[model samples]
Target: MHINPYGEDPVRLALDLINDPPGSASELGRRCAAAGLVIDVPPGAADLAETNRFLAAWLGVVDAPDETARAERLNALLAQAAAYPRLTNHAADGWHLHYRDPDRPLAAALRALISVGTALHLSGRGMHRLGRCAAAGCERPFADLSRTGRQRYCSPACANRDAVRRHRNRTAADHG
Candidate 1:
C-alpha cells in the first residue's frame, strides 16, 4: 500500500492553477495531467469554469487575515469537498486512500484533493505555511514547503528582485 502525500502535491497544483489559469478544458486537462493527476475523464467547459471558481474560493483561505479565519475558510472547503476516506487501486496503482467519491468530474476531484491536502499541510506543517508572495508587486500564492518553511516569495526571482529593490532604496537614502 502506497500512502499518497496528499498535502504537498495538491497545494502545489492549486498554486499552479492560480498562477497560470488554464484557458480551456483541454488545457486544464493537460495541465492537471502534467501535474501528475490521473485524468479519469476529459474535462469540459463546465469543468474549466468550475475549477476557476473553486480556485477563487481556495484563494480566500490563502488570503485569510488570521489563523482562525484561515481555518474557518478551509473548514468550509473541506465540508464541501471531502468525503469519507476509502482505499482504491485505480489505474493499476497501488492501493491508496481517496477522500472523494469515485468517477467524480475533474473539478470535483480537484476540489476534494486540494481541500484535504491543504488541511493536512496546515496541520502537519504549520498554519503559516501558505500565503502570497511578499514581493512588493507580486501577490502570487505560494506554499511554504521549503526545508526551513520560511518561503515568502513565489520564486527566487521575486526574492532577488525584492532584495535589489530594498538595497537600492537604502543606498538612495544614505546618499540623500
Candidate 2:
C-alpha cells in the first residue's frame, strides 16, 4: 500500500533540504527518493534552483514573530502552490490524493508537497511545533513531530550539549 506522502515525511524532507541543501539536482532527486517522494519527473538544474527558492521562503514561516505571522507566511506558500486536490493512481501504486497536477517536475511537486504537509503538521500538531533550536549556539530550524510536542532542540546531540553546558554553568556558579 502507498503511504500518505503529504505529512511528516515532507516536513522532515523540507528540514533536511533547508539544513543542508543539495549541490545539484541529481542529489536532490536522490534525497527525495530516499525520503519517499519518488516523482515521475527527475530533478534538473531548474528544479534545484526552484527548490532552493521555496526553502528560503519556507524558512520565513519557521522564523515568524508569532502564530499570526507564521500562519500568514504559510498561507502564502499554500496559495502559490494551490491546486485542486484530486485522486489518482498515476504511479500505479494505488489511488491516492495529490495537491498538484501530475507529471510536474520535482520542484513543482516539492512546493505543493512541503507547503501542504507543513500546514497539516502545524494545524494538526500546533503552530508552535516549528521553530529554530532553543540551544543557544544553534539556530537551525526543525519541525517538532515528537509525541509530546515539546521539542526545543534540533537533535539529541544539541539537546545533550546544551544540557551539559547548563549544568556546568550552574555548578560553577554554585561553587563560586
lDDT of 2 by residue, 24-112 (tens): 99999999998877678988899999999999999999999999999999999999998999998876789888888888999999999
What C-alpha lDDT values do all the predictions have? 0.91, 0.91
Candidate 1 lDDT, 35-59, residue by residue in tens? 8788777899999999999999999
Number of clashes in model 1? 0
Can you give the TM-score per candidate against the true fold?
A: 0.94, 0.94
Residue pairs clashing in model 2 are none
Clashes of 2: 0
